[model samples]
Target: MADTTGTVEASQPGRYSVPGPPPRPRSQLVGTGFAIAAGAMAVAGALGHYMARRHASGIDPGHDWLAGQSVPNPQLVYALITLLVSVVTAHWAVWASGRGERGHTWVGMALTLVMGLAFFNMVMFSLNRMEFEIGSGEWATLAFAVTGLSLAILIVGMFYLGLMTLRSLGGSVGRDRSTPLGAAVFFWDFAVLAWAATWYVVYVVK
Candidate 1:
């Protein structure tokens, strides 16, 4: 009756049939990071979208346009989506951790993907493609390069993780499957560190 494990043992009320090492209890840091990411995005996305909407003198109100422009700015919406997805992944990680093992690869992959899209597509691309342009500034150029690199890394990391997940999937089900998922999630999480640090240097602080 667990999300990661689809079965429960009748003999042991709190026991599951999933095989594996005792689930690695996540540190507070992991949970806190996930919560912060989600909450910050929700609040920030709402505020950003609202501001863009109100400040746009020419934006269309009919289709959620911010500046009366024909094109709709789904930037804020995208941020919100990433935040929500991250929240869900964090919850799954916690649940599986509670059960004494990491959850499925689906959960880990989902986390990697959510973070990638948000950190790369939403935050990085938004800054480069929207906030700044090719002729904007020296700093802008640097930002573009760094974000581009992060996105590149994200793509490669996803592919590697995908392969790892495939190998794990070829094995028996249950606890057997959690390790690759955990490893992928862990590696992808490391990608976040690379991404944030790199982008921060190029864009935020430079």
Candidate 2:
């Protein structure tokens, strides 16, 4: 034993260390929202294609043609305005959220204020023009049914989010940072779901 080498190995157990910065950049509203919206739209689009083909024989040309009547409808003006404002707000929110500036609070507040008005206007216009009665027992009925239900959901959800966003901005003055980005993501997801459902009905049932 004395002749053997006296060197001994350090026998310490490996220890786990606390995580530091994230492996990747933190995700913002736009990043995740885009993915979600895109996915929903894709699903809707595929379903819509299938429905359109299947219901082609059943779809009444007279009924389907009515959609053309509203082509370039005056409602487009309001819809465009809403789209533009939302786009701007979305861009700003994404930028601000990415930058982590507390000032995005003000941007979110402004967006919520203006978007609420646009949302109300659109809802009024849609409600005024949209009317449907029960159709013959067929794909027509199914399409109409789905579209109507989807529209109802969209109308309620959109307005609700608008109110929530506005409240987050305007409920008393303080430096409390609001999760406007999260609201925006939620709103977009709602919209995508509505569009998918509505257009799917139209495409397949038509």
* Top candidate by TM-score: 2
TM-score for model 1?
Answer: 0.43
Residue-level error in angstroms, candidate 1, position 30: 22
lDDT of 1 by residue, 1-206 (tens): 64785575467754666676885565533654564455345434533443444345244433332222232235534644564455456446534633544245346545745565554556644554464565454334444555555555556556655665565446523453455445445545544445555543433323
Give the TM-scores of the predictions, in the order they appear: 0.43, 0.48
Question: What pairs collide in candidate 1?
Answer: 1-7, 19-175, 23-100, 23-101, 58-67, 58-68, 59-67, 59-68, 60-68
Instruction: In model 2, state the lDDT of residue 2.
Output: 67
Clash count, candidate 1: 9
RMSD of every candidate to native, in Å, equals: 14.9, 9.5
Global local distance difference test of model 1: 0.48
- lDDT digits (tens) for residues 1-206 of candidate 2: 46877787765565455557654333544554664566567546655654665456446653554433332234634654564566566546545554555367457546744674575576456545644334633444554555455555455445644554455445422322334445454655465356545553454234
